[model samples]
Target: MPYLVPPHIPSGRIADGAQPALTADGGLCLRPWEYTDAPAVLAAFSDPVIQRWHLRRADSEDEALDWIEQWQEAWLAETGIHWAVVRPKGGTSDGAEQLLGRVSLRSLMLGTGQAECAYWTLPAARGQGVAPRSVTAVARWAFDEIGFERLELAHSVMNAASCRVAAKSGFSLEGTRRRGHLHADGWHDMHIHARVRDDEASCVPVEGAGPGAP
Candidate 1:
């Protein structure tokens, strides 16, 4: 049996090249994770909020390193990619970057031109619009550069903060899935949000949160 349409993204289109660093609103940078970031990853997973929403914890630095390695490998595999959301330590371009959050295109389905965007901001970065900024940047890249037709974002209905981030990032609320996902506490209703490539509004950054803003 033959399909009527071609794959939205051709194979090797992403796996053939190196991942590029992305700049987002509010002086944020999204880059590939490095081994040196293991400590920060450990710290993030250690946070109670992250552990709850993410449903996993890094028990040690070595485990965190493994996770970083997997993120790098995922990019090469072209199944998905993850970025470390960072803020430069000083007011200069040469300054070191501090990790504030993470954004990823997970469960990538290139043939169908779809993927799920997931993110979590550090405790200190919460309420600072880090998640939405990173998400918007990634979505633009996915749509404009990679030719993906749609991106989805889903969160537990109980996660009000995540729901707000989805809206701010231009992912429209599609609907709710009853007990769609199981968290550590058990089942929870999930809100599904999405942004399509043709939606010009999806490319616009939220007010007061555009790139390079203070």
Candidate 2:
């Protein structure tokens, strides 16, 4: 028996190539995480705000390195891709790239053409619109370049900041899932937001991103 619908995106399309760095607004760029960034990763996990949302902490430099290694390998496995949002060399006075936050397309389903977007900003990068810009950049790459049909972003209802980022990045409010996740504090209602490829409110034309402009 043949299936009625074929896969929207074929396997190995993305995994076959190196993960490309994406350009975002405010002179920020999203690039693959490197081993040398372990210290910054460790610092990010130490921040109370980041820890509260992330639910995991790096106990040592070794743990942070492990996490970075996992992120790098996930790209080749086609399960996920994580980008380190950074202020590239010229963007900072120190002339060295500065890690600002992280954005990822997790739970990626190539056949389904969907994935979940997740992000967190370091304490110093908060209030700079880093989260929203980074997310939009990745969405462009996923939708315009890789043919992803839909991308979803979910956050705890109590997280007003996440809600705002979703809105800013043009993700529409779908609904709420009661007790969607259990956090350290307790079970909390989760807000579900989504942006489809053809959505006018979110999907915009990617400059020089090939023929598909939806």
Candidate 3:
């Protein structure tokens, strides 16, 4: 599919362009973050499960707001894209703007025609297909509207859930590297998954592509 430069920005520049807000089942909308979202974003990242899964660092409310501000700048700069997974009012039993998660496409390799995908969801949002659904939505948009020929994602082997999200989003298991990153605990092995445009329909599975896919 041909990439559509977001209506608000030109093709080559990196500012003011954005992916459209996407609606998921249950009236959830994945839309670009706003400055007003700081509080909810802080609360979402403060969850122990998200911190453990993504190895998020400690931060004060001000620091968190700064991070969100930086993300906003980057999003408008067109260097990367970030979205907040919001559960709109009156749709869910909670009746709140549940900041379920965040997803991103970054590290664009224009020469190589590739980009990296990343995401993390609150524990309350896990096991409900949120991560996979969000990842797939972004991947599709990346290919169809962002002009990427391939997408890549990496996760520590211990992050079985993330690996599963990559698979369910259509990424094929690529390979593993030993001790690629040092996290809070120690060095950990990493698995790399990739999806190329040509293989979208027949990508091969990684180690756990079935019921044990994670």
In each prediction, how many residue pairs overlap at the backbone (N, C-alpha, C within less than 3 A)? 0, 0, 2
lDDT of 3 by residue, 1-214 (tens): 8655533324454454445787754456889887778777778667766666567743667767887787777766666778888787766787767777888878866555677887877656667767667767777777776567888888888877777777777888889989987777898888899887765623322223211121
Q: List the lowest-lDDT window of 10 residues for candidate 3.
A: 205-214
lDDT for model 1: 0.85
Model 2 over residues 39-154: C-alpha lDDT tens digits?
Answer: 99999889877777777889999999999999999999999999999999988887988898999999998888999999888877777778888888898889999999999999
Find the number of clashing residue pairs for candidate 1: 0
lDDT of 3 at 209: 25
Could you tell which candidate, 1 or 3, scores higher by TM-score? 1
What TM-score against the true fold does each predicted structure earn?
0.92, 0.92, 0.82
lDDT of 2 at 73: 97
| Candidate-wise lDDT, in order | 0.85, 0.84, 0.70
lDDT of 1 by residue, 13-104 (tens): 89899999999978889999999999999998888888888889999999999999999999989888999999967844677677888899
Candidate 2 shows a clash count of 0
**Model 3 segments more than 4 A misplaced:** 1-16, 201-214
